[model samples]
Target: MKFKTIVVVNDFSFVNGGAGQVAISSAIGLLAKGYRVILFTAVGPVDENLAKQGIEVVCLNQYDILHDPNRMRAIIQGVWNVKAKVVFEKLLRTLNRTETIIHFHAWSKGLSSSLFSVTKKQGFKTVVTLHDFFLYCPNGGFYDYPHNKICTKNPLGLSCIFCNCDARGYIQKIWRCIRQVIQNKMLYQIDGTLFLSISDLSTSIFKKYYPNKKALLFRVNNPVALLPLFERIHVENNNAYLFVARLSLEKGIDLFCEAVSQLGLEGYVLGDGYLLDTYKKKYPMIKFIGWVTGVEKENYIKMAKAFIFPSKWYETFGLSVAEMQSCGIPCIVPDKNAAAEQIIDGETGFIFQIGSLESLKDKIVCMEKMKMEDLARMSQQAFEYSLRENYSMETHLENITKLYDSNF
Candidate 1:
């Protein structure tokens, strides 16, 4: 393979998010393939794992929108960070434009759309992975936090602008709309730019927003990191249903707790968020394991009867769903979102009606009644599909490398 320098852009140098992990994994894969790779971010002290891979990281060491305590400054920077533009411009100028591909995984965390405009202004061909819906929706998820449901209002429309869907409040919603305006002004920046959408569901959701001009769009599945199947035995019986995502309202954490409480079933929440204390107080029986990774995460999934992926938002891809499937664990997800795409219903796992607590509880009741032989068959099917399909890191690397080669 001919050596080509690849610039991977994201909000964080640390692998704390789905988009950031994908960006880091891709950079590492490129480096192993003998390509020069650079991870460009607006936040942090970098992850030691990236440095160990010999990939160069350029971080502005700025605070992300979530971490920045200065509310006014964070809002302003979220719209357009002039500092990021200046720093990124300098980095772009140093790289060989002809052999370099600027691939953006995320920008909503801190690096705003100004980075896109700057990349285009510098006359470099760029690629953006639609990790979320920030390019179209103001809050990223079309989810209405206040209402606890998905919002149908068009992006920046009168209704969308008026409705307070932001988790913070209406004031934050207004600021987000302002950011959307700034983002729209530079939508042309991504014109003729390649888009690496993580799922067909994401492409369908944002298809209307892509520039009118022809732009290459590739459907690249998120690479799931998993322990080899041969390393352990699959669990044939488990008592509790597990929820492993961030314990946020959009993740349907409340719904899970409610259903678990109603059914008088054992429920284990393996992640933490703002609503953790509130939910724990309301549902004392439900167990909260806080945040966990590696073996701890895998063991939690393995010991569960079925993994519950009740995301209320239109997730681009559910990494946890895929990870659980890899471990021969069935996942019960909403029939909407990208997680539903991974399930085969009665084969791999099950699907419940979107935003319906009753439907989820009924599914759990049905699973509890399932025969051991039937459950084992479904678990085996889930594992085989995840391992054989494009979800594996090997397949992700191959697809990315081919995309890179095509651009060259």
Candidate 2:
């Protein structure tokens, strides 16, 4: 029952974020490994790489919930997406179920849980990549957005349902809760499905919410393309601390801003989000370079003293933290979530007390005052550790292919 075909499912065809990047990259890798691959997405002007690599793509050509102009339609489609269900079902019917694996990477942004019903009705084996906690938490991140902290309430329970946790408002929170209820129902209907976790911390957090006795889950490292050792960023000589993520509340942008401002140190933010204008007005001291990709983005990362990943929630895997470390630039992460797991604390990078500005400032000051010799040593260790543990595409492909084959 080895899988010969993989239908890679995500909300977007382009690399909109981490999940889309993983879905597209892995689909390409799977094709190179001789498996027939198809990209099934809800949003696109499809990425050129997929077509260039000869991978088949089936796109819905739609907008994600947040960006959709029609509010009512986005809300409805975010819950069930009848069109996606029908079209995806038509696609599945043409394939031999036993030979195809539905590798679902993301959905909450657009496609919704209806895709699950499609796979269930068609009797196809599926592997869900735990890119985030949307399968359990209503808002994807188990975060109290307004309060700017990690949430402990049981998801969808009375306490969880009553919390006004959505970034938009309480009404949106309730709507997302309704969406989660249907998604959970569709999730629990399938049996013998595999949940692919990207980090041990992500695996642990997921296990807490999904304690169903029948659930199957395991950790699989996300493939990080290690940078060439010769191309290492001379971060030890840099003076500015860097923060790269959506300028959102749960990401702890406020914490980064306050910490760097209070210390009067140079700080730079590399990404953009809805909070950009507000952050610019509030923290004029911190430089906010609007979202830039490719060479421009890498150039910003290269000028960093250290990456400040002050995520307030339990991250599934802070891909940027891993990328920074892999590039021989240490990251300063809070002592919570998967970002901390990527660092060797005090060696590769420092881990501050979660949500404590004082703790974060202490680490930043430590990094700021460190001798050049010590900082260089830390960079060297970060690069060496990445090579040993955080593997590249080849190893990632091998591990994933084994999972696909063995699951059958």
Candidate 3:
């Protein structure tokens, strides 16, 4: 029953975003641990780093829902990807189910929940990481996109369906609801164990939906590679704050801009999205550096006074906050969601009331008034806290492997 190999499934082989990065990182870690790891993805050219690590990668060479040109086909595939089912069926036949664990990172983006039905029909034990609320909620963020508020209505309920929550419009909302039904059916057909990144919040929400008494749940925090102690403490802190995430509305980039403008403070954005050009034109004061990675992205964070995470949604886990903290950088997060959990208010960083520009500006103004020595103390505390609690790549590998071993 000991797992000798792990199959990590997601929608993309390339690191598209947080979920893809997590899946690829986990595969690389398994390879380093001398375990046979396979990266199974529906739409990808394949990540070179994973292939370089001597891990097997099977990419279907298709397009994700976002990239697919055919709208109808994309919508259908988003619900049920029959091609993925057939391909995975053949792959499942090759693996010894007892020695292999199929761990799914994401499916809603492209792969769809049809893969779960494949695993059940093939009689293989599987695990699913709650990367987002796609398995339970229609729009995947438990957010009412039209209203730009947190959604509390029950999924698929008449009230939920009656309300238009999709960012695209009412049509997309209906499509997402239909897709949710398909995902739910496939999810309930199998008894896969759950891996929750933020156990306190995500686990509870998931349990409310599924509530399978026999389901095994594990709290495995997403891994963040710790920077060296010298880099963590030695970075020169500038006067400006930094925001690093996709430049989207739900990400609260607009809110961050409004807060900075109110305080007459400088802010820098390090990621790109649909709203990049619009944000650039609307807020000429804030510098939008498009997107950055590796040392460049790290340097932006290191030079900033504080990392500002103003996401309006309830994040399952805020990986960027952990990364910033690991580098001895204080963070400003909303009082709600997982980002708040990463920082100790007024100590490691500050947490402001959600959706309040005055509260956000006040928090930033407070940080602006803090003395250099006080800031340094907070940064040191942030770094120490991250290293101790926020898991590293090594810790994550050990945790997931232990879960695999214990299950069987």
lDDT of each: 0.84, 0.87, 0.83
lDDT of 2 by residue, 1-408 (tens): 288899999999899888887899989999998899999999988999999999999999988988999999998999989889989999999999979999999988889999998888888998999998897889888898788888889999999999998888999999999998898889889888998899887888777788585577867888865444445678778888889889887788989999999999898998888899999999998999988777787777778888899988888888888778777888899876888888888999999988888999999899888899899889888877776784687888888788878866
Q: What is candidate 1's lDDT per residue for 289-336, written digit by digit as tens?
A: 999977787667667888898899889989888878777888899987
Per-prediction TM-score to the true structure, in the order listed: 0.95, 0.96, 0.96
Against the correct fold, how does model 2 do in TM-score? 0.96
For residues 1-408, write the lDDT of model 3, one tens digit per residue. 277888889899898878888889889988888889888888878888876789998888889997799988898898889899899889989999888889899988888888989888877878888889887789999898878888999989999999988888998999999888887777787865555545467877877876575677777888776555345654235777898999887898988999887788888999889999998898999999988987787667666888899998888888888878887889999876878888899899999987777888999888888888898888889988986795777888888888888776
Model 2 misplaced regions, further than 4 Å: 226-230
After superposing all C-alphas onto the true structure, candidate 2 shows an RMSD in angstroms of 1.6
* Cα distance off (Å), candidate 3, residue 106: 0.7
* lDDT of model 2 at position 133: 87
